[model samples]
Target: MHPALSIIVFTTLSGLGYGLATALGTGLLDPAATATKAAHLLALALIAAGLMSSTLHLGNPQRAWRAFSQWRSSWLSREGVMAVLTFLPLAASAFLAIFESRYEPALGLAGAALSLVTVYCTAMIYASLKSVQTWHTPLTPLCYLLFALAGGFSLSTFFAAMGGGNLLLSSGLAAFFVCLAWIAKLVWRNRMNTLRPISTPETATGLGFIGKVRLFERPHINDNYLTNEMGFRVARKHAVKLAALSFGLGGIVPVALLLGLLALGAAHPAVAVGVALLAVLSHITGMLVERWLFFAEARHAVMNYYGG
Candidate 1:
């Protein structure tokens, strides 16, 4: 499918936002600390920005509100509903953290669980689409959830380092999550590399019993909406290069920095904070590239009719 900039930004930013919010909900940071207050504001900003960006891909942003009506059957609608519901407890918890300087176990835990459910719903938006073989798998949601945790904990490590909290522990969690996310991503990519098209030209036309089906004439003289939106293609070489870059930036560097933070034992607060910041930046950039590839590399079964 065509890689839409709005969706990419939406997923990447929201994933990070939800992840960070999850960390806060779990009471991972000291509620009374100034850094915790800042983190709360940051999480809200990221989520709001991402949710807003998501509307850009819609043909009519004004009608986007209609998406909420299909929650019974639509993953997209479920995501919208969950996103709004998740924001409530999260915002309330943030309010308490910022003003009252306290963490309520019930609110925090509720927000954390809801935050994860929202992310799962978002991933299911793509994973549920049977037309796209690349995205139709259990691994899709697994990668999405793992990446959210990895990025969330990495950002948490930065705040923990800034506040002089348990920097070592936060960094250790960050490193562990980063490792887990990358491993899952590697497995996902391998599946993409090996899986054959479930729907080919022959199967699509139901002519496999007779002979191979080939496009003798163009479907249209000019490109149509389906061709433009669902027929995007990417070269294998560029994909390999981008995949390497994503793994390195989004996974390896963050893990290394976080592991180093663990080894330092909170001896150098300033250095730890700086390193944590770099890891967050690198991880975000890497995930952006990964999200791009996630869309670019996907092959929609509808393309078989278009001679894709």
Candidate 2:
């Protein structure tokens, strides 16, 4: 459950890239506009950066390609395959939008669908682990999808404002998605707060009927891989502060800014774009903190054996 920087960057960057692609694919932005070309290029850049970051987390980066062959039985493999597959349509859509200045509806839609499915596969890689009760809920995928949409829409608002396109619509949609993502996140957190631990030392040892089980000695004289990886702990007080920070910066601030921009109604394009850019920055920063917490707060079932 240790929070690896590589994976954190991968999820956040890739989610944003795919979300932006989805917005473009769904016709939220005009394909013929110069801004659309910039957006397409930006999306590809984010996706490529994220994909590269993931390889750094592997034991053997050169051998990572072998992961693609396990798609039938592994969510990780499915994610790997889907991530590669998604590039086809996304690249095609980008080419047409950039060079031809034309939006092929079918290709765009296909790319969007594949992008979302790849995100789903990423979520499932964590959610399917029965040992991690916190991530085993349906809310995991929902959170991932909603956050992607929220981040994507926020970025789109910035592009629209800068491009002098439909600022009102883009900002409005961004605000709505931000609110929804925060609500869903609050619900998920509340559930985790109240849910009983499904695995305890006594339960793990199948000796609950005898008496309370307690650790009498260290598993080893020193820390091992399992302890370092699965036995991560965070202070409850720190978690509370971080959660507040995440909600305020990622959700509430973006909503307020976008709504304020919408209310101003036809403000100078430069001012609107500036505010949109601020919102995008705040949201991405908040998401990074939230993702850090996501990994840090998890308690692996294997930890029960080690007196976690």
Candidate 2 lDDT tens digits, 1-308: 88889999999999999888887787777777898889999988998898999899888889898999999999999999999999999999999989998889999999989989988998999999989898989999899998988998898888888682778988898999999988889998998788898999999988889999887787688989998887778634389899889898999898999998899766688889889999999999999989988888888899888888
Candidate 1 on 21-69: residue-level lDDT in tens? 9989989899999999999999999999999999988878898889989
Backbone clashes in model 1, listed as residue pairs: none
Cα distance off (Å), candidate 1, residue 12: 0.3
Candidate 1 TM-score, C-alpha based: 0.98
> How big is the positional error of residue 172 in model 2, measured in Å on the Cα after superposition?
1.3
lDDT for residue 73 in candidate 1, whole number 0-100: 98
Q: Report how far residue 211 has shifted in candidate 2, in Å.
A: 0.2
* Model 2 lowest lDDT segment of ten: 228-237
RMSD list, candidates in order: 1.1, 1.2
In model 2, state the lDDT of residue 116. Answer: 91
Name the regions of candidate 1 deviating beyond 4 angstroms. Answer: 235-237
